[model samples]
Target: MENLTFEQLPQAMRLLHEKLDRLEQRFEEQNTLQDAETIFNVTQAAAFLHLSVATLYVKTSRREVPFNKQGKRLYFYKAELDEWVRKGRKKTMSEIREEAGQHVLSTKRRT
Candidate 1:
């Protein structure tokens, strides 16, 4: 890197301070708004989950996915949907093998 002269150092520092202040303002603006819970209908929920509405309907009828029934209307909570996706997470093959190894070792110790 080329060395900055004494005169250039103050100007560089001042420019950095201005950029930092702008970034701080943007962050503050983003966080100042209150976040409210969002509800999604079947169409929206299916779109959010990247599935077809028919599939979502089937899943909901089968009680496979998290949902709320209000009269005949179906509702989904955004947070609940996120949790549902998280709960369906599958472990990798290596992870399953490692867990099996641990179980085998524990069982042998008890024998």
Candidate 2:
């Protein structure tokens, strides 16, 4: 310790700081990757979508929602679920009424 000069001490400290920074960066990256790879449980998925667990189960049973089954546990992919919701989005009342009216008119004309 006493044999080391001031210049050597600074170099040693700099190297130590750089090593710690690299370690911290790697840890952060690893944590991010782990988070991305994590799959959500049914409750978590329901909460994420703001829906009830029963509704989630119904959707899963109807094959309207995306899920993954591992042994006894069920998991949902956040991205896939989000995309599915986006694709099968709810329609406005006006659109539904218009379609219903069109159907009724067509049926009446056929009769």
Candidate 3:
């Protein structure tokens, strides 16, 4: 302990502080990236959507939900799911069919 001079202590403290600052910056960057990444596992995706895992699987199978499969694992893109919900918010199959039928009738009258 007595071997080192007083000047060495300040340099050592400065080096330690620099290392700590770098570590803090790295941690913040990783946290930001994690917040940006929307990939979720099946359980996480189900929980996020407030749906059962089985129902999620069924919807995935029906192509109603977008998913990514990497080997045996499945992942959902949160953005795609959000967009899917937005697109489905205001219309049903019957409404769509009725609109198509009206279009057809209007076309026939014009002809």
Candidate of highest lDDT: 1
Model 3 lDDT vs. the true structure? 0.88
Candidate 2 TM-score to native: 0.48
Write one digit per residue (lDDT tens) for candidate 1, span 7-49.
9999989988999999999887765432116789999999999
Could you give candidate 3's per-residue lDDT for residues 16-46 as a string of tens digits? Answer: 8999999999999987667547788999999
**Poorest 10 consecutive residues by lDDT, candidate 2:** 30-39
Number of the top-ranking candidate, with TM-score as the measure: 1
Question: Candidate 1, which segments miss by more than 4 Å at Cα?
Answer: 1-36
Clashes per candidate, residues 3 or more apart or on different chains:
0, 0, 0
List, residue by residue over 1-110, the lDDT tens digit for candidate 2.
Answer: 45778779998889889999999999999887776576799999999989999999998889888899889888997767767779987899999999999999999999
- TM-score of every model versus the real structure: 0.67, 0.48, 0.50
Q: State which candidate, 1 or 3, has the greater lDDT.
A: 1
Stretches of model 2 off by over 4 angstroms after superposition: 1-36, 90-111
lDDT of each: 0.90, 0.88, 0.88
Worst 10 residues of 3 by lDDT: 30-39
lDDT of 1: 0.90
